[model samples]
Target: MDEHTPLLYPSPESPAEDTNAQCTGVSGVYHRIGLRLVGSLIVDSIPVTLSYILQNSTQTVSILVTGRLGPEELSAAAFSMMLAFVTGWCIALGGGSALDTLGSQSFTGGNRPTDLSIHFQRCVILLWLLFIPVAILWAFIEPVLLAIGEPARLCKDVQAIMRILIFGAPGYIAFESLKKYLQCQGIMRASTIVLILVSPINLVLNIFFVHYTPLGMLGCPVALSITYWLCFILLILVTLLSPTHKANATWGGLQLQAAMNLKSCFGFLKLALPGILMVGTEWAAFEIVALAAGKLGELSLAAQSVIMTTDQIIATIPFSFGVVASTRVGNLLGARSAIGARNAAHASALTSVLVGSAIMTAMLAARNDFGYMFSDDEDVVRLVSQVMPLLASFQIADGLANACGGTLRGQGRQHLGAIFNIIAYYVLALPIGITLAFSTRMHLGLKGLWIGKSICFGSVRRLTHMILGQVIGLFTVGTAEYIVVWLGTNWDKEVEKSVVRNAEEAKRRTLLEQHE
Candidate 1:
């Protein structure tokens, strides 16, 4: 294969490129680009969405089973699992993205087909080693939570749940590495296939362990651990035994060269650290908002909780679509097709925007009834409906930011993503949101915080630039903040009192639970 060699799937009508070679005039170019974008996104999205749905379903089953045990079990497991996700899975997702650069490039650029296999093992080893500290955190999570003033009973129960889930840490992390390995090979459907097979099995296991077995509440995590291992093992088997994998020769027995090189070790850390921080900063910030929402009145806080829960479900699409972008761009870059890589990145961005649009449309249609799924409180329902437009706006930014971040990861430029996140969220969104949340002069309540967040991404900038034929200008600051400040002028002092009330209630609950 030489520089002039055409893409393997080159368009029949064009010898130059596979994706965008059919254009003649400006209209033709845009038409071809549109077709290519939609084609590739459809190809990538289905498998990714299927896999995530199954995985989330697994979590749902565990929660539902534990919910039957008791409220304490349900809440404890949820809290512990959320923390574990932050500590373990976020790192795994970010860290595994290194392979988005390494494995993809090696697949097309290396002399040996086995390089991807070696790199996969290296990632597995590196991630497992990284999991050590996270595992330690899980072991002593009670003290850490206590030190941070978490409710005493919640702390104790979460610690126990985490200990059970800890058994799955290596498997979960290593499975992430395995998923990347297959993805780099353009084997997008494998994990989806494997998870679909395993998801039902996991539900049965959950029922047996959490409900039928004497393990009860603890059994929920145990079942999850087992499910994680199953996913890992089955993916490995797919790599080894699948007819598609037979041609790759990707699985040469593991090598220790990665372990032997300090440069390589440090290289992995350098790429992975920024990636982790990029994801960690935003997620950690969102966690803070969850904390602050309680400072609003009870009705506001309840509405916030239900809305956030629903948002989590819708959130999966953009993030998963971003994964599709990362994988697609990485593969094209690895093949050294700059044009193809650019096209893939642009297409992915478009796909995210489209997906976000779909979400917004769905939210608009569902707003009246969505809150009723969680609570019957009219205040909560009304507040949630009021915030739907803001939520819809943020969903767009979440999609675009995540998609762009994925592209950066594919290029091995995870640092850029960290910078984007730090500047966009930490330096801007968080402070803006906090100020709006606590603003007595602007009694915007929960809507203020969300408005502050959405404005950071500047939908006005995106729309203005789009209308002006300069999409690049979306990166600039927009007039949304001015709009937010002007609209937020009703001064409500009771929000501050709610903060004090919430703090007192938390302490009382903790003390009372301790006595129980």
Candidate 2:
């Protein structure tokens, strides 16, 4: 069928009458839908969460294995991984997010199923093209670090590791893109399976390369590179050989034309650029906090490391929730079910709050002892105990923001989320944090940094009021604003937009196909 042909499903302008019928019993229907959506989101999020935890462990394992080499080796591996997280990993996450919008929509949009494949191809091509400069930068990073007045020996070590890791950058980005491809098709467990199969191998490889093979400190990256490529290959095999063929139905093979489609490439970037900003801005802000923590003295820095590491692990839950929300909302939109999309968004927000609160309670209960998990230093443990409450307080806000951000992504409104992050973190939270952290009078120290972040994450109460007085917390403000916006959204309009978006893509594909 030509692209101009009508979708097999009801058009947005003429939604199925049953949707209207359900709206008549709005309260009961919505309650049922919310429960069902929450259950589905949780079920979907578990595998995704496990996948992230496993994937993250690979890098952490590398650090653990290599850190035993010496302090300098440990420092180099840690620094190199941080740089990789900000640059290549962020690009993979943010760049691949475009597929979260387009691919999910396409899969349910009733266009040719291959449109999902086309979007995946476009994402892979763009991200790889983007990685070229990153690789080049890694090759020359030592000079940049030196220019910044970093220790020369440390810079040299970091540069060496980065250069080795560069070989695997494409594999990392491609694997992320492929995960999105499969995820959009409802194949959520594939990546988890791949990681389950690869994690042990990764650990073995790290040991073999670093100790047995004589590669020394550099061996960690080599093992990592091999592990990344293996993950990508295994995922590809899973897609090809799966009994269900959910992913296979969408895979149209490696079409050179799809990758080379200029219009499609630009379309992907439209969402991707904002997605990059959404991820990078928040991540960079945390990194900035980490750098500032280092300036506070070794004790404070160590405490900050403990807190940050725990936060990253805790964050995977909301992050997974966001992922599931994005896919569900996008699928509902593509299917022209405005009510379903709206319910899913609400359910996602509710789920995040409930989950975040539970996490916060647990963290609070463990605050006194949590630091012992990372370090035995009394000073560091004491400082971490002091700061844990502030961190715990904002979990709900973080969860809400993530859920809302995911909803925005599914609705093709990533730019709005990016804007909120920039304003909240950069303009509001960071400035307030740095000021309080270093202020001669306040003397809040590590607490000040977290307080600033907590404000951005949504802590609003007597403490915040006492600190800032009339000023509202950014996290509270941003998440509230996001909820308001979502409440005000016209899901019918969103459905229309999704339909129009898919139709335009189909038209473009048709023209390209005809020309070919």
Candidate 3:
């Protein structure tokens, strides 16, 4: 398709053509399609957003509960959780994203009904295996922390927290994997329902264990472990007991033979490895900024922590948009409706921009007071207020990146998305951020760190463009470039690839069954 092609042109087979025919004008037809897709995306995105919000809240509550003990204890809990996110949680989310591509497509591909379940099973097993090393690392993290020159006391505390948290890692990984299993089948609310029921229980457990019980600071991890396992179990029960059996068609009981097939494993990894890097690189970049914040002293660290926490929560909005986009696009591609997939992709990007702008406005409005929710210290609070504008400006670019990234995932181009992230954050964003953050002449401190990040987000205006010039020009361009690339996509080509992918899976299943 070329730039002159209409954004919502109905393919000859599309039912949308009937609706388009009834419209008074071509513009009217496009308008209706835009509204329909945006509305559907919003409806699907809400539950996903809530699920993420509730999921993050469980960990945030743990830190809040432990914060009452002492600063040192709170810091250790936060630090340990950060480590958990970077290692175990990142592996779960990043690796599980493979299913965002495979599971969603398989569910709608029609060629093999069991492909979704088979992919899910393989993902869970692979992620569990991946976590083994992380578990081992957590078990011995104290020495590693000390070797890196962390205070001996803080290292011990972090070690204690991580060791207990380790037992719960598999449950968290499995739960994330299962959520994808259900979501790809259009069961968007199951995980949300599970989290809604479990989040309050998690809060009560944290309060009781940390305060009413004898465990004290250690109780935080105990509660977290129990909560993670409870979420996993509840999700399973929901799947099995749903009146509709929303997942039943795609989930053919455990297929250990197919799941463990050598070629199947390699095929899954082809999509999964880049997915890990696509997500992990961005997460690691932020973690690096957090570490750098520590060097600016306690106040900067505290402010950075609060901003990062708030950003994570806010990030769910765009992330949910991406999730829904990935699923919707995959489903359309699977059904061989290229027009529908392309329209959905464009709608998601447009909706994200609208949602992101609203978020930016809210953040800007609350800039001065938002910091108070996380800290009472005047210095940290002030520093946070000063940094809020940069953070606020980032929401739009962040949303665009996520929406476009989702489209790429749907297209099975995660490797391309991974390349963008590596280039955007590491090669472009970080070096600039770190230099300004640490440079003696600049003395930008926390603000410098965020300035570099804001640039990476490509939110800076002409002033920044003029100041930074070509050295930062590429970094300032942002994820909008992805949208341009997406516009050029051969949607029909993508549909063919999905068909081939499903055909391959069907052939593999046939071979595996014959061998058995």
Clashing pairs in 2: 456-475, 458-475, 458-476
How far residue 452's Cα lies from its native spot in candidate 3, in Å, is 1.4
| TM-score of candidate 2 versus the correct structure, residues matched by position | 0.92
Off by over 4 Å in 2: 1-32, 246-248, 458-479
Q: Write the per-residue lDDT of candidate 2 for residues 1-516, one digit (tens) a residue.
A: 211223222233544446544564336544545454566677788999999999999999999999989999998998899899987898999888888899888888947888888898889889999889989999989999999888999999999999999999989999999999887776788899999999999999999999888799999999999999999999999888765455237777788785677887888899998998889888889888998999998988999999888988989999998898888788789988786777777778878878988998899899999889988888888899999988887777788888887888888888987887787778777888899999999878988898777766542333355256322344455356555656668889999989998998888878878998
Displacement of the residue 290 alpha carbon in candidate 2, Å: 1.1
* Model 3 score (lDDT): 0.81
For model 3, give the 10-residue run with minimal summed lDDT: 1-10
Models sorted by lDDT, best on top: 2, 3, 1
Candidate 1: list runs displaced more than 4 Å.
1-14, 17-34, 258-260, 455-516
Top-down TM-score ranking? 2, 3, 1
Which one wins by lDDT: 2 or 3? 2
- Going through the candidates in order, what is the number of backbone clashes in each? 0, 3, 0
User: lDDT per model, in order?
Assistant: 0.69, 0.82, 0.81
- Tens digits of per-residue lDDT for model 3, 1-516: 211222222343767655655655325534655665677777788999999999999999999999999999898988888888887798888888888888888887756677888999999999898889989999999999999899999999999999999988999999999998877776788899999999999999999999999889999999999999999999999988765444346778989888877887887788888988888888889889989999999889889988888889899999999888888788778877776777777778778878988988898899898888988888878999999987887787777778888888887888987887787678767888888889989888998888777665553243357136422342245344554646568888999998888888888888878887
